[model samples]
Target chain A: MVDIPILMIGKNVVVPIQTELNDIGAKKMQEDVLYKIEKTTASGLVIDVSAVSIIDSFLGRILVDTSKMAKLMGTESVIVGMKKEVVLTLIQLGLRMENLNTALNLEDGLNLLRKLQETLHGKISG
Target chain B: MEKYQDSRDSGQGQSVSTTIFVASYEDVIVARQKVRELMNEMKFSLLDQTRVVTAVSELSRNIIVHAGKGEMTIIKYDESGRRGFRCIFEDKGPGIADIDLAMREGYSTTNSLGLGLSGSKKLCKNFSIQSTRGKGTRIEIAEWK
Candidate 1:
């Protein structure tokens, strides 16, 4: 079972998926990401999947569920670096992930999160 | 990890095939990797490779999830100048009683998105399934280059 590493930067946490994860590994990642979000009280979450070659229904569901769980915990999540082929397969599988925020890369993911935070802050302060 | 390779000639053409035993999640990953390698060797487009590999992931996982175990045979075929890859999954578990219901989206006996069968069908160019209650199940999927 490969361990997916989670790194915390400032008020956000980034998880780079570096290998094709088995079912057990994928579930473990969900649990660990949620636990890290709670432990750090991160305001944003970025899941990087540039290295992942495929996203089947199982993994796709986990990502959607994880982002939803993170939202409930007050952490906005962005999925980043999905390969073109992976996205094509996901759509062909009829799995729709409409609720998750996405970006092309980690930098874009972080920037989008920052923008989201600013909008929330403005809502509160202005 | 039991596997073997062989070459055979069918009416369509000559083919090379490999069979992998699927009994665990780790085996599923192995199955997907082997399929990807074969697709790459066949010069399948990246999109086609991803589509077939993802289908293999779902189908192989079904062997572990629905059935206790199964075997997957991957064949690389050159039929009259046409090249493609084919995968056959067979299991001796309690087979699906209702094929129509099982094929329906969101229909799952196990707690899942229930897209394995139907979704995999959509991912490949050719798909077929045969199952008998208390007997076994076999699914064949194929894609051409």
Candidate 2:
């Protein structure tokens, strides 16, 4: 099954990938997240994957796709709490997923989002 | 691509290696769960456990999508003072012709940009593939601790 939880954290959307998600589940997640991002006008998306044990290249691609969708909708996507083994496997798979930003944990992700927002605001006359 | 030392000989007489049928998606999930349990009992780190589980998922899925129906075995191995788990996937489906080509990165038979074979090889410490034109394919992967 591909069920995961998406919650609101201030103006951000926090997605916790607590289990192995199949392709169907991830596609649904992308739709739900994009809808919420537009409706709430959120500024950041932090995907917590500390609990995820297995991630295939296909799932890795979906994460990159979600980040692209969020970026287009004015939300910065940040993946947080990736396990060390997961990182090693991802590298071994030779799939350097483009446009996906990551942090150490949820707290770090939030800080990163805030800093990016501040920079955007400071640079864009808003 | 590379096959290393096998520790199966030390298993007294017979090991209760589990054979899983891969005729549908449900079987893949069952195999993943079983592999996770074996890894957990072996006290593999979360990352190592996940790596093996991910490889299992990929191989099992390939059996279903590429081949019609196949089987896999999960057995615990202890070779050369290293203890870990090994998974063997076998299919009687149409086998791969060019192993060298299949092992290349960025190559796919179907359009999902399928990571296909090479990715799985990279995820494990020991990997080997044997295939015949119309006979079948056998893939073995092992990670030692």
Candidate 3:
């Protein structure tokens, strides 16, 4: 199985899904992301899915679960770069990702992560 | 990969068809890619292609997750000026006992989101399912261009 690379910048980690991942691969990715977050103490996580063409129910669940798990680990997560068609399909599939945060692109995802980090820090400091 | 096979039958004014055996998660990806390529070659819109491919992924995965093994048949049809693609998924697993409950969204016996059947129905233009306890299950879905 191919391992999805997780890049660390500052206090955040960016995981760009570059190919079609099978079920095992996706689950592994989730585990890897969580491990990296814990290992690096990342305050923010960005999952870029621009290269992913399909986001079926299983993949959708993995994303939601990953974000929720990250939240429990004290890391904020944002999903980014979803194609228009993928968005439409995910909605039609009735997979409501209510707890997940999303952005339009990588830059926007990073910015959102930064904002989330600030709010979190503010709450702790103030 | 021993069970993998491909045979296309096309005749004058006849629908073209291809069958794929799905037994693992890798087969699910292959099935989705096959449907996407076929839809693209048929000039389907980008949105339609994505929707159909997503549905294919769900159904094929269902076959592996629920039945352990199954086959997917994709057919290209042009009937009376209406052109479309039809996908049939057949599995001989332990068959669903309650079709109604199984069709209900958010109701799953395997701890999944329970969107496989219901969501696939919404994605296609035409959808149908047949199953018998102790027998097997078959699902057919079609999308017109």
Candidate 4:
């Protein structure tokens, strides 16, 4: 369990979580994303959790909170690469992840971000 | 909650199960991995394993948020012929004052989405919980494959 890396791609900040995220790590991720959103001036944030092995309610809320904060800061956030079983489980846990945007995979998420950018400003820069 | 703890093994002779404590954020991850391995050993599909592990994550986290300390037990069950897994989460902290209110979606005592209890129940085939305000809380969920 090393640190979950957050990268910047095009006009988006991408966080590809490859391992399980604990409470401390989840909070750190939220803070890092918020700080980077301001520094990169990215229009969108994409989080790929395909490789993640687990997600609890606390981390679930942190994710939702992060996306909401990102939205408030003028950045759209998309979470992608969720497993089918995970989705079913998440639904049961009452965290629809509904409050946050989502995609089927990384490419779709990036594309979605592009479309969102165009729709938001009537321009395609990403 | 004791209803799921049937003494009868159904067929596999003596049953085998392991219990792990959940006290901190790190312990939450450990509980998840333990469940993941147990599910995998049971030959669960990738989706099934993920679903159960996700359930473990939410419930173990509940121990930390609500009780500040707790433990989880992973058990393998053989019923009338089907095979699956069972997990029990127990906490000694304050019990939920309202079970119905806690089960509702979007309900939260700590600004959370209020999904841990209700949501964990959804991921498995069977779910049950028992609690007394001054005592502790115990939750049990079972899935057959």
Worst 10 residues of 2 chain A by lDDT: A18-27
Q: lDDT tens string, model 1, A25-112?
A: 9999999999999999899999999999999999999999999999999999999999999998898899989989999999999999
How far in Å is the alpha carbon of B86 misplaced in model 3? 1.0
Stretches of model 3 off by over 4 angstroms after superposition: B1-12
Range of the 10 consecutive residues with the lowest summed lDDT in candidate 4 chain B = B1-10
What are the per-residue Cα lDDT tens digits for candidate 4 across B1-145?
A: 1123335444555456777878998898888888788778778888788777777788888999989998998787655576777788999989989888887776889877677777777776788988889788999988888
When sorted by lDDT, best at the front, the candidate numbers are 1, 3, 2, 4
Model 3 interface Cα RMSD in Å: 0.5
Query: How big is the positional error of residue B24 in model 2, measured in Å on the Cα after superposition?
Result: 3.7
Instruction: For candidate 3, write residues B69-138 as lDDT tens digits.
Output: 9999887776567688789999999999999999999889899999998998899888999999988999
The window of 10 residues in a row where model 2 chain B has the poorest summed lDDT is: B1-10
- Model 3: lDDT of residue B109: 87
Model 4 clashing residue pairs (backbone): A92-B119, A93-B119
Give i-RMS (Å) per prediction.
0.5, 1.7, 0.5, 1.8
TM-score of chain A of each: 0.97, 0.94, 0.97, 0.91
Tens digits of per-residue lDDT, candidate 1, B2-85, equal 567867745656788889999999999999999999888878888988999999999999999988899999888777767887
Better of 1 and 3 by lDDT: 1
The residue pairs found clashing in candidate 3 are none
